[model samples]
Target: MKVVYLPGPKSPLEIREIQDPQPGADQILIAIHYAGLNHRDLWMKLGQYGGKKEDLVLGSDGSGIVKEVGSAVDKKWIGKKVFVHAAQDWGPDKNAQGKQFTILGNPRQGTFAEYLAIEAQYVYEIPAYLDLKNAAAIPLAGVTAFRALFTRARLKPGQKVLIRGVGAGTALFALQFAIAENCAVYVTSGQDHKIDQAIALGAKGGVNYKNENWSTTLQEMAGQFDVIVDSAAGSEFGKLIELCNPGGTIVNFGGTAGAITNITAQRIYWKQLNILGTTMGNNEDFQNMLGFLERKKLEPIIDKVFPMSHAEDAFKRMEKSEQFGKILLEIKS
Candidate 1:
């Protein structure tokens, strides 16, 4: 099996031949067809996430065909096309994740290889509407967005919603899901073209966050939002608080921009606002996300695809935040 390995922080990614992984008693071995990049991988490379230095296969999202099933698994799964959920050990609780929950592509070897072995329970059949390339891009981002909007924010149809950082994968998924629910969706982006793209995708409108007093301008234009799905938590978080309607919810999943500063406690209490935090998701969220995609016939946005041999370039694109959607690495069968 050919695999990409990370030697350490500040070191270049190198390809090498490694032994193929075998399935455990409750696992399945998959021949990977495509792997998707996430910001988590970039953080690990920059030594921000403290991932293992040696023998690390950096990827969390992938779609492939089952090559073999473990003894305890049904043989019928063999040759079935599927996408692997990145979270593991989610346990039975739907309200929250278990203590042992872990995402793929860190301490454990991941899908950035020719083959990967994962628990059979974590794999979902790819919907007929999605091809392998697009299916590979859904697991991490889709699940996160689903949980943030439906589970945390409890967004309802016809409500006004705003998704911060419109160009990233999770944010785009949130926009799509909110729109499908018949919500009036708005978005914010540092780039004006991204805001335009979101509007083209059925968003009611959008604003450029780079502009001064953009939040105030948006509030006047669109009124207060019922829900706000945010990834970047910085000075803008205070603005987000002001933009939400009374009793509205704001869900935060990622903080790429840095720590939040100058939040007003009085506003939260006076408005009866809900501020929630969520990570990837529980297994229930993953199943619901898949069902939503199938029901809506939704397709994930793919900005570009790179051959597995050029995986380094994919990482570079993600690091520079140059992509507007999922960046995929295609594995040649």
Candidate 2:
């Protein structure tokens, strides 16, 4: 198998030949066809996120076909095309492979390889309606957005939601789901151009956070939003708190603009607001998200596609912070 692996933190990705993994009793081997590149993988590569030091393969989302199934696994799934779950639930055994939970590309080996072995149950059949290339883009970001809005916040149709960043993968989906539910959606982007992009994606309108006194402009639309979702919470964290209506919820999946920021206690207490944190969701959430995509035929915004051999270029493009959507690695079949 050919793999692009990080031998250590802050190290360059080394694409080379590696031994293929054998499936365990409840696991299966998959021939990876594509891998989705995310900023999270870069964070892990830089040791900013906690991942194992043992030659990590950096990717979270992937689409692949089953090559072989282990004993005790469903034979029906053999030869089926599937999307893989990035999360691993390996228990506390020092020698245990794949013991770490829900970690696909971080502390564990990821989908940058030509092949991978994972729990049979973690392999899900890609919706027949979806393109295989698109299925690779769905695992982490899709599941996270679905879990936060639907499970944690319970956003209802016709409600209002404000997103802190417009270009982020999850934020994009938040806007789409809001549109699907008939909710009024607003977003903020530091780059003035993303506001128009957000509008095209069905957001009612967006505010330009880069403009001087944009905070006051946003405040003008008072009591407008019932929910707020953000990955960029630098100085805007306080302003985002102010964007929400009373009893509104703020969903935080990540912080792209430095994690630590000041949020006034009065904002949380006086408004009776909620700040909910979400990570990659469970299997059920992934399944439900797939169902939604299958039914609605939703597509995650695609920023660019790089060949698997050009993984470094893909990472560089994502780090530029200018992409309009998900960056993908297009693997040769």
Best by lDDT: 1
Please give the RMSD to the true structure for each candidate, in Å.
1.1, 3.6
TM-score of each: 0.98, 0.92
Candidate 1 lDDT over residue span 1-333, tens digit each: 998888888678889899999899999999999999999988888888854766688889999999999999999999999999999988778777887778899899988999999999899899988989999999999999999999998989999999999998999999999999999999999999999989989999989998998998899889999999999998779999999999999999988889999999999999999999998998889999989998999999899999988888998998887888899999755
lDDT, model 1, position 112 = 92
CA shift of 175, model 1, Å: 0.5
C-alpha lDDT (0 to 100) for residue 130 of candidate 1 = 93
Per residue, candidate 2 scores C-alpha lDDT tens digits across 53-161 of: 6578778888888899899898887889988888567344422224345678766678888888888767889887777788888788888788888878888988988
